[model samples]
Target chain A: MAFFEAKNITKFFGGLAAVNGVNFRVEQGQTYGLIGPNGSGKTTIFNLINGYFPLTTGEIYFGGRKISGLKTYRICQEGIGRTFQVVKPLKRMTVLDNVVASAFLRTRSKREAVRLAEETIAFCGLTAHKDKLAKSLPIASRKRLEITRALATKPKLLLLDETAAGLNPSEVDEAIRLIRKINESGITIIIVEHIMKVIMTISDRILAINHGMVIAEGTPAEVASNHEVVAAYLGEDYDAQS
Target chain B: MKQYSGAILLLAVMLVFPLAVQDAYYQHLMILVLLWVAIGSGWNLISGYAGQVLFGAAAFFGVGAYTAALLSHKLGISAWWGLPLGAVITFALALPFGWVCFRLRGPYFALATLALNEIFRHIATIWESLTEGMVGILVMQTFVSKVPYYYIALGIAVASVLTVEIVVRSRWGYYFVSIREDQDAAESLGIDTLRYKSVALCLSSCMIGLAGALYTNYMGFIDPRVVFSLHDVSIAAILVGIIGGVGTVSGPAVGAFIMVAVMEIFRSGGFGFLGKLSSATGSPFVATLTKYISEAHVLSFGLLVIFVILYLPNGVVGDWPILKKKLLFWRRQATV
Candidate 1:
């Protein structure tokens, strides 16, 4: 059995199917990349997996146990942590406190949570901004804070939604390095990213989708070369010559 | 230890205040201030820290006051027992209310609480046999002197403030602030936002309920209009929280004092100075002005709220640095 599997998951907002018959699986210790255009249901799939929205039809399994119907927090407790596409920092709290809040999920002790949070902060190279309020941090730091918060939860599978969306090129490279470090710690990662370079470099397997349906699956080279994936990105007009 | 020295000194002053001022009128005002301390702290916990604005604190307040009044009137027991019993009942009330109302966010949740306040007021008024309706319930005073009431109110106020201090420093405090900041992020991080929100509501309800029971014991009377009043009890509680500081632990204490002092000053026409000035001057204009000042207490209170929101925004404790800088600007200028 796969480490994490979404079996025919579908979601409907009234007549519109936000996610229609989507299926994907992530093996243990693999970085799975999901790429698509805006409103292509990438974030919706994350929401469905975390139980933020109820699935219309399908099942999600984590470590061979069904997890689709569980509550969002319960899904997190099951070792699946996630970050938002739009960074959601606890604005009034300091960066350390923001991570400490997430660390509370693993341990009830405040001291322990602080210690864990400090480690995560140091690991993510946010030590300098640790005392600064989350709202006061720049967008790059906020994105890193988002990942740092999720990392502190000690998840086996981390779902990162657009962590590189608003980052500069150097900042994006730093994020890629941080993600690589997290994956090196034997944690599985499923990333939804717009930057093709980051996704191509980091993803062990890539799933390409369009209009809520899977267009291609299985690798940077394979998906990048696929005709449908090309059409999805550049539109249907595909000629050999420029 | 150094951080708590200020709090410890303040507590010492509060302990000696009633003894230092034996005047019954002054003691009564202090009692009101302390009662507000509890109510404001309770409001701060859920509304400020947890970020769930409770527009109907009067619902729990009225329930607590009636619990005491009814216990004394119908059950033939000391109204003092209402303190513990009222807290329990208010906890029971808050649990289900939070479960239902917490589903709604922001203004919608606030509106639901407002509806709850109105519902309780109607229940108290319509249930004449039980609550004595608008005629009100009058409980006999347990003590002729206000000293005991002063100490009791002080204890409750201190406990309420301490409760906020301890909780905000703990894991629960982090959870509450996270929920206030972003419910989705908190939930994504595995914090059950609903359960934590309910926890904050129940704790706050119990604190406010205790104050209500104390109010019944001290004031010796409670009508639906007085205890469950939207303008008086409910709005007064919000004003205390806001005027002090929304989420700061010490904000409510500072806010409660200012609110009670402002209301009393306006209601008593600057503690009778206007009345005295009018009589001394024997001028028609002064007399009319005095009367207007006394009658316009609520209006002045509204103006004070607007002023605080516009200038302080964060309440006294939260905006202390700004206040300190502005107040000491003259000293800095002189040094320069």
Candidate 2:
């Protein structure tokens, strides 16, 4: 049984298929990458897997249990944690409280929740700003807070959507390091990133999609070398450039 | 220590207030202020902390008041028992009302609550068989003295404040705040936004309802207009919440005092201070001005709300720091 699988997932927004008939599986502990052009339904697929939206024509399973119909929060309790493409922090709350609220999902004790929040915040290099308001944090910290908040939920499978989107080179490198650490901690990671450096360096296997359909699925090098993936990204001049 | 001292002082003052001041009118004002505290605290729970922007506080309050009135009129039960019973009946009103209205967010929810206030008022008025129509149900006062009633109101007000403080400190409070900040983010993080919202509404409604029951017992009279009034009950509740500091626990207590004082002062021509001045001066103009001011009390209340919105938008407690800074800056300029 797959650790996570989306079978024949399709979604429509008034006769337009935002995501169509996409099926994929993630093995336990696998670091999977998803890449596509803008508006190619990358985040839409993330939303479906996490149960943010009901699947129009498919089923999603976690540990072989059908989960496509569950609410987003229920899926989180079932051990699937996710970060938003656009970071959503509890703005008025302290950064520590933001993580503690999610950590409460697993533990009933406030002390335990606090412990988990502090540990996760420290891991994200946010210890110094623990008491600061989430809104007052810088963008890089806000993005990291989103990931840390998701991590505190203690999920078996983690979905990170554009976690490294707006960072500079140094911050992106740091984000890549943090993501690798998360992946190595025995959690299955499915990441959606437009940063080529991030996608190429982190993913053990990469899946390329165009118009919500998988165009190529293989090792990072294999997916990068595929003609369809290249054409979708660089246009017909890709072969001419080579 | 400093944080608790003010509360302790307030507790001491309230405990000795009735004994210190034997004036029935002053005691009556205190009871009204305390009742507003309970109602405003409830309103703050949903509208302020939970971010629901409720406009139908009277719905819960009226339901609670009617529950007490009905229990006595129909079942021959003590109106005192209606205190707890009122909350239970309010839950009946809130469960369905929250389930329906929480589905609508922002200003739409506000409009829905206003509509509900009207609906409840009409139901109480038109359901003459059970409610006894416009004649209104009258309950006998349990005591001839105002002291016992003041203490009862104080106890409930204290209970409500403690409840709010505890809830705000607990995990449920955080959930309410998260829903307020961003419902989508809250849901994605595994919080049931609707369920938490309903929980907030239930707490708020029951508290407001409890206040209504207390009001019926104290006033010994009930009418749809008096209990379910849009301006007097609903808007007054909102004003208390906002003036006290919408998101803070202690805010409504302070706000309640200011609100009552304003209402009383304007309604009685500065509590008859203006009347004294007018007569002492022996001027027709001063006498006429005093009468007009008393007559325009409601307008004065409206103008006060407008100023609070323009200047202290976050209320006294929430914007205390800004208020302090402005004050200090002016003082510094004077010193220079």
Candidate 3:
């Protein structure tokens, strides 16, 4: 059985299908990539799976338990943590406070939460700016904080929404390495990113969606050469080495 | 270190107030100060930190007061028992109101809560058989001293400040702050913004309700007019919170202290300044000037609110660090 599966997941906004009958699965100890053009419903899929929005139709199974309509916080408590497409740090709070807040959901004691937050902050390379408010951080650091905040929830299956969108090439490389480290730490990761290089580099398997439907699914090499995947990329050759 | 010192100093002052002020009138004034501080701080919890402006504070306060009064007068239950009972009832009542208002944000929530205050006041007045109507309930205490009442009021105020501090530090507190910053962002992070909002409103109502119980016991009276005027307690709390700084923990306390002290001073002898000028000059218009004291307070409150929002958007306490930096900069400039 897959560790996380969304079977026949459908979401609509006033008769317009944002995500139309999508079925996908991620196994434990796997790294998957969700690549789609703008408006292809990648973030919407993330939203539906995490309970951010109610599904028009479908069931989501996490660790083999159906959890489609449960409250978002409860889903996080159940170890299905997620980051946002747009980084949403608690703008007024310090970096330490931002992480500590999410840590509270996992641990009851403030002391334990603080210790965990401190560790996560150092791990994310935000130790130097720990005392600064989240809004004061640069965009890349803000995105890192968002990831750390989600990780503090101790999720079994972590969904990262465009975590490498705004990073430079070197930063993208670092993020890819960090994401691999996260998965290596025993947390399965499904990353949705538009950066083709980072996506191909980090993903063991790639699922490409277009117009609210999956166009192709295969290994990075196969998906790179697949005619339909190339057509979805508007005929630009995807250099597998890039 | 500095924050702790300020807090300790304030606590010491409160502890010594009863002993320092022997006059019954002044002691009564001090009690009112403590009472308003609790109510304002409670209002800050929802409006300041959570960014949900509620105008139903008077309604919760009135319910608590009437609950305590009814329990004491009708069933002979002690005022102490009624305090927690009132808080629970108000918190329960807050749930439905929260459910309705949770769907409304910002100004709409404020208007809905203001409407609730009027609705509750009317219900209290019309429910004559139970609430004693507009005639109100009076409790001639079994004890003679007002010192016990003083201590209880002070204790509740301190507890309110501590509770707000703790909740702001907790995980739920972060959810509240996130909701305040951006609801959509909070939801995207898998935080249930509505549930956190409802929890904030419920907790805020409970604290305000407890303040109501204290007020009724201390004043020995319960009336819809006195207990349920949103313009009296609700507006005062919002204004104090704004003037002190909205979301900061100590903002409401500082705002409440300054507002009450100024109003009390004006009420006691500042109006008499015009009276003295009238007697000395035999001017009819001079006597008319003192009548404007209350109106002047209202005007001052309005002006202060505008100034704070426009210039000191963080409230006085939130701006302290900036002010200190600027002062240090100016001092270095002068020395050079």
Candidate 4:
């Protein structure tokens, strides 16, 4: 049975449908990649699934329990943790504190939360920058801080939104490796990314969307060969093997 | 070790301030400083930490003062019970406003709070039968001297500062700061931003209400205009927080001291130098200054605000850490 499922998920802002009639499922501990063009609604789908926005019409199930329309914090308590595309770190707080804030949901004790936050910071290679304000970190490290913050919640299902957006090639490679390590730690992940190379390398299965509708869904190689996926990527001439 | 010792020394100095300044007038000024320090710090809890920036704090303060006055005069009750009752009512009154205002951002929310304060003032004024309208209520005041009031004010000040310190260092404080920094980010991190904000406002309103009760009993009066005046409730409290430090624990305390001292200096005829300047121009500039300055300290407060926001954005206490760091570096260079 699927650990999480979204059936006929539809979201409309005013009259325009931002995410139209989408269905997807993730098995326990599996890694899935969501790929789409600029307005393909990948982020919207993530928002709907994470309970950040209410679905105009549809249902979301987590751990075999219906979670649609639940408050965002309640959904987080149910073990669905997410990172934002824009990376909203607490500007006035230290990087360690940003992570510690997330860690508070798991444990109310300050000492325990600090310990977990420190461990998670080290895991994300952010120990050196722990005392620095979150706003002062470089982009890559800020992204990593966001990841560590989400990891601190100890969620069963993690949603990462464009985590590798502004990274250099080597940084993107490192992000992919860290993501796999997260999965190996018994957490399921659904990644929405535009970096094709990272997507193809790290994704066990791919779900592609265009104009708020699913265009293709399959294994990395299979989805790469699909005609709609090829057209969405600008042309068939673009190398998918990369 | 040095920082710890410095904190200890400061505490010692604070304990001696009342005793060293034996003049009744000087004691009165210190009492006012302690009062503002408590009320301003409480205001900072929701406005500074949660980023709500409420301008309706005076409304709660007035509500608490009136409630205590009415209970004591009309109902013949002690302030100890009246204080908590007044706080409960104010906290309840805050919920609907907080619920509606939380949805608004920046200027809109500020305007909402300001409007609410006006509405509260109007209600207190027109409800003359109960509130005594502008005539105000007065208690028997069997005690004559202002000395007892000073200690009472000081005790409340210490309590308020300690409460703020605890709330800020706790998990609730972290949640509030997170909400201030980024509301959407805080929500995603599993913080119920709306609930946290409401809770903070409740706690903040109660503290102000307690201060209000204390004020009414000390003055032995509760006039609508005096109780609901935004000058002391909003402007003074806000100026204290901003000038001292908006979010830091010591910011509001330091701000209260500076604001009280400056206002007292101006009020005590130190601006006589302006009289000499007026003799040359014959514009009655000194007269104009004395008249308006005596009426309301708003203009001077406004200028101070502009100066602080422009040059001292981080506030007084917020700069301590950075200044200490700079001083340490200079000392090292000198030794070398």
Candidate 5:
């Protein structure tokens, strides 16, 4: 059985199917990539998995437990953690406090929560800025803080939405390396990204969708070469011939 | 230890204030300040830390006040029992209210609390048999001297501040601030936003309710208009939080002191100093000016709130560094 599974998931926004009959599965320790053009429901799938909003009609199984109808925080407590597409830092809190807040999910002790937050902050290389308010961090550090907060929740599965969206090349590379490290630590990651290099290099398997329907799913190389995925997302002007 | 020295010193001064000053009038003013400390701390918890502005603190305050008054009027018990009972009842009231209204965020939630204040007032006014209607309920004052009441107010104030300090330092404190900063983010990270908000609201309600009970026991009378006045109780609570510093632990204490002093100053026309000048000079102009100032307390209070928002938006405690710098600059100029 897959570690995480979405079965025939469908969502309707007043007669429009934002996500329709989409199905995907992730192995226990794999990093999965989701890619599509704008409004292709990439983030919608992430939302559905995180239970941000109720699934109009679907079943989401994490560790074989149905989580589709659960509350967002309950879903997180069930070991699925997620980041927003637009960074949602606790703006008034110090970075350390932001992570400490997340760490409280697992432990009630302030000392333990702070200890976990400090470890996560160090792991994410945000120790230098831990004392600074979250709003003061630069964009790259803010994105890192997002991941750092999610990591501190100690999730079995992490959903990252556009983690490398606005970073420069070097920062993108750093994000990719951080993601690899996260996956190596035995956490399954489902990443949504528009940046081809970061997604192509990190994702062990890739799923391509368009108009809320799965266009292709295979190894990264296979999905990259699929004709329909090429036409719908990668653009036909660039040849699959190469 | 070093950080708490200032708080410790302030507390020591509060402990000695009523003892040092024999005048009943000044002690009354100090009691009002202490009462505001509780109310303002309650407001700060829900609105400042949890980021849910409560515009109707008088709902809880009035309920608490009535609880004490009704206990004496109907049950023939000591009104002092109202303190604990009022806290429990207010907690109960806030639980369901928060569950329903927390669905609405920001200004909408504030409007719902305002509606609650009005509802409570209307109920108290209409229910003549139970509440004595607009006639108001009167409780016998527990003590003839003001010192006992002063100490009780001080105890409530201390408890309120300590409650905030402990909650803000706990893991729950972080959760509250996280919810305030960003609700969705807090939820995404496994913080139960609604439950935590309910916790904050319930706590705030309990604190305000305690203050109300104290008010009834001390003041000996409470009309719906007096306890539930939107301007006097609700807005004053907000003013205390805002003028003190919204999320800071000790902000409410400072704000309560300033607000009570300002209100008294205007209400008394500079603590009767203007009246003295008017009578001494036998000047109609001075007498008229004093009367106008006394009557325009609310107007002047509103103007002060505007000034605070403009210049010290974070309140005195939150903007202390900026305030200290400005004061130091002035001091330096004076020396030069």
Candidate 6:
């Protein structure tokens, strides 16, 4: 049985559909990759699934329980944690505190929260920068902080939204390592990323979306070879070049 | 060690203040300082830490004061009951006010609070049958000695400051700051932004309301203009936050003392010291100087605010490092 499922999910902003008639599911402890061009409803699907935006139509189920239209925080309490494409760290807070805030959602004790935050910071390789304010960190570290904070929530299903958008090759590689470690911990992940290397390397299965609908869904190699996926995003000539 | 020492010394001074200062006028100024400390600390919690800049704290303050006054006027309840009752009433006001207003973020929410302040003021002034209108209510003071009021006010100040300190160091403080930094981020992380914001607002309104109740008990008078005045209650609260340090626990305490001192200096023309100096000299120049200083106190206060904004945007406690460095440099130059 699927651990998380979005069935025929649709979202309309005014009259236009931002996301339309999409269905996807993540098995327990699986890494699911969502790939799409700009404004193709990839993020919208994540938003809909995470309960950040109410679906205009269709239902989302987590372990057979319907979760559509639940408040974002309520969904989070049900064990879904998400990161933004644009990182939003508490500027006035230390990096440790950024994670501590999220940790408090699961634990009422400040000591436990701090301990969890510190452990997550170390896991994300941010222990050295723990005392530094979040706003002072460079983008690479800020991205790590975003992921660290999400990890602090101890979610069963984690959503990564463009987590590797603007990173150097080494930084992207580091993020991939962190992501794989996260997946190995028995937490399911759905990653929306523009980086092909990161997507192809870690994704057990890939879903390609375009114009608010799914174009292809399969194993990484299978989806990479799909004609519609090539035409929509991978480019028709990409096969010839290889 | 230095931080702990300064706080202990201040507490010691406050404990023996009424004893040391035999002058009733001086004792009154200290009482005002304590009252402002409670109000300022309340303002600091929601605005400085929570990032909800309230423009109408007077709404809750007035509610608390009126709650106390009405209890005495209508039910003949001991005015002291108003202290706790005011906190409850103000919390009631904040629940819906925060629910409706938290939807509007940043400055718009602030404006909503300001509007609430004005609305409360108008209600208090116009509700003749219930509030006795602008004519106000008069309560008998329980104590004429000023010592009881002084201690009670001091206790309130300490309690408020301690509450703010504890909240800022707790999980709620983190949630409040997170909401202020980015509500969307906070929500994404599973923080109920609205709930935490409501918590911060409730805490603030409750403290201010208690202060309001205390005011009525101490002064033996209640009027819409005095308790709910925009300039006195709301702006004064904001000014206290700015002057002390918006986000820090110690900022409001420092700010309250400074604000009260400055206000008294201007209001009483240097605690009537200027009047004595003018009379002693009896010179036209001295008398003219004294007249200008007393009459221009408000102008001077306005100028001081401008100076504070331009030079010390972070407030005295927040900018103490820079101030210390400057002071050290000046001392070195003087010795040279």
Which residue pairs show collisions in model 4?
none
Q: What TM-score would you give candidate 6 relative to the actual structure?
A: 0.96
| Lowest lDDT block of 10, candidate 6 chain A | A233-242
lDDT of 5 by residue, B221-270 (tens): 99999999999999999999999999999999999999989989999999
**Candidate 4: residue B103 lDDT (0-100):** 85
Per-residue error (Å), model 6, residue A118: 1.2
- Listed in order, the DockQ scores are 0.93, 0.76, 0.41, 0.80, 0.95, 0.83
lDDT, candidate 1, at A43: 96
Ranking by TM-score: 5, 1, 2, 6, 4, 3
Q: Candidate 2's residue-wise lDDT over B1-336, tens digit each?
A: 897898999899999999999999999999999999999999999988999988999999999998888889899999988899999989878988888878898999999999999999999999999998788999888899999999999999999999999998788888898888888888888888888999999999989999999999999999999999999999999999888788999889988998999988999998899999999999999999999999998898889888888899999888889989999999999999
Better lDDT candidate (1, 3): 1
lDDT, candidates in the order shown: 0.94, 0.92, 0.84, 0.85, 0.95, 0.91
lDDT of 1 by residue, A153-204 (tens): 9999999999998889999999999999999999999999999989999999
Choose the strongest candidate by DockQ.
5
Where does candidate 2 chain A have its weakest 10-residue lDDT segment? A233-242
For candidate 6, write residues A112-184 as lDDT tens digits: 9999999999988999999999999999999999999999999999999989889999999999999999999
The collision pairs in model 3 are B245-B315
State the lDDT of candidate 1 residue by residue for B184-229, as single tens digits: 9999999999999999999999999999999999999999999999
lDDT of 3 by residue, B1-336 (tens): 886898898899889988888777767767787887788889999999999997778989998888889888899988777789989999999999898778988899999999999999999999899888899999867546667778888898899899899899777888888788877666645577888899998889988999998888888887999899877887888877887888889888888877887786555436357667778998877666766664576666677778778877887788878767878999999999
List ranges where model 3 is wrong by over 4 Å: A235-242, B1-3, B76-81, B141-146, B182-199, B265-271, B281-288, B322-336
Stretches off by above 4 angstroms in model 5 are A234-242
Per-model root-mean-square deviation over C-alphas:
1.3, 1.4, 3.5, 3.8, 1.2, 1.8
Quality class of the docking in candidate 1, CAPRI style:
high
Q: What is the per-residue lDDT of model 3 for residues A18-130, given as tens digits with 9 covering 90 to 100?
A: 88888888889899899888999999998888887999998999998989999877788788888887888889889888888787776778899899999988877789989
Steric clash pairs (candidate 6): none
Pairs that clash in candidate 1:
none
